[model samples]
Target: MNKRNFLVTGASLAAVALLSTACSTTGGASGDPAAQRAAIDSAVESSLARLFQENSNAKELVASAKGVLVFPNFVSAGFIVGGASGTGALRKGGKSTAHFRMTEASVGLLAGAQSQGVFILFMTQEALNSFEASRGWTAGVDGSITFVNVGAGVNVSTQTAQQPIIGFALTNGGLMGNLSLNGSKISPLTFN
Candidate 1:
């Protein structure tokens, strides 16, 4: 096989293995559909509560946002090529309007394994509407997300607050450092 094909195959295999391990540990998203939805909802609630407690700014953002999407866990592993997938819910008017699955893959000088929670806030009705209307929304192509670096004692800046869409990555310790959702894809997750 050519070098490019070899690398692509390797990356695909690595991503599948990593995601499988993650799902198994986190009550795998297979099996009962009701169970999977419950798991996602439970994680979203806990993660959002923790985020709000740690940073009041996030709570305020949620209060004002047209929609809020939260992914409670994303297991990421990579060696040159990497991928991450997580289940989450979209909240409108403080209730889950829909469930979504988010996945992202990248190829670059990257290597590591980590898990994190992600929050995306749509500050405008237009943005939220567009996101919901899409069959499958891909970051940076379908729409752009302004990523905010979050950490202990970190404050959301005024400029960041004004963005149409904002995203944050958080871990057990606290919010992860700089990260992006550039190539991430979001799709509706229907429960069977």
Candidate 2:
């Protein structure tokens, strides 16, 4: 290869390496559990701030919800082979309600990325019942929700936000996620 071509190849490789490193680094962890936990705390603060801004019956849900969980950064990867997992917490009345795990997996067709999103689970009997009785849930399945960009949801204010469509009537394809939040211990998030 010519000198110029060699230099170009080296530069490209370096760029890819930096990008890969950034992709894998979530919540600003210094490769330490404590740092990651700190990142999680910050993410939760942002989630709550989002909660105040978004008017999605989140208030009503929180009012009656058994708890609210905020996942500031949930990362996953997949392609020929796939497995995913992330950490988040449950909050009640602006406090740490509980900690929960979220995961997804599949075989054959796939897409991979390190991503961040929000999850609102209603624990109260009424809220849970409403979720169950809903006719359908669409993450963008039928346009009930709008995604300004691929994999991005508009922030939920009083109403409307981009969506990842985790659940709803229109959620289709992909491996169904396993969510076990029932009766899970919850600790309210403390902003102070």
How would you encode candidate 2's per-residue C-alpha lDDT over 88-158 as one tens digit per residue? Answer: 66566777644445444434454444454555545444543443344432222322212222112323342
lDDT values, one for every candidate: 0.83, 0.44
Q: Summarize candidate 1's per-residue lDDT along 16-135 as a digit string, tens digits.
A: 787767755334555687778777888899999998887778888889999999989877778777788887899999888788888888778777788888999999999999999999
Q: Looking at candidate 2, what is the lDDT of residue 91?
A: 62
Model 2, global lDDT: 0.44
Looking at model 1, residue 161 earns an lDDT score of: 91
The TM-score obtained by model 1 is 0.86
Q: What is the lDDT of residue 79 in candidate 2?
A: 46
Angstrom error at residue 184, model 2: 14
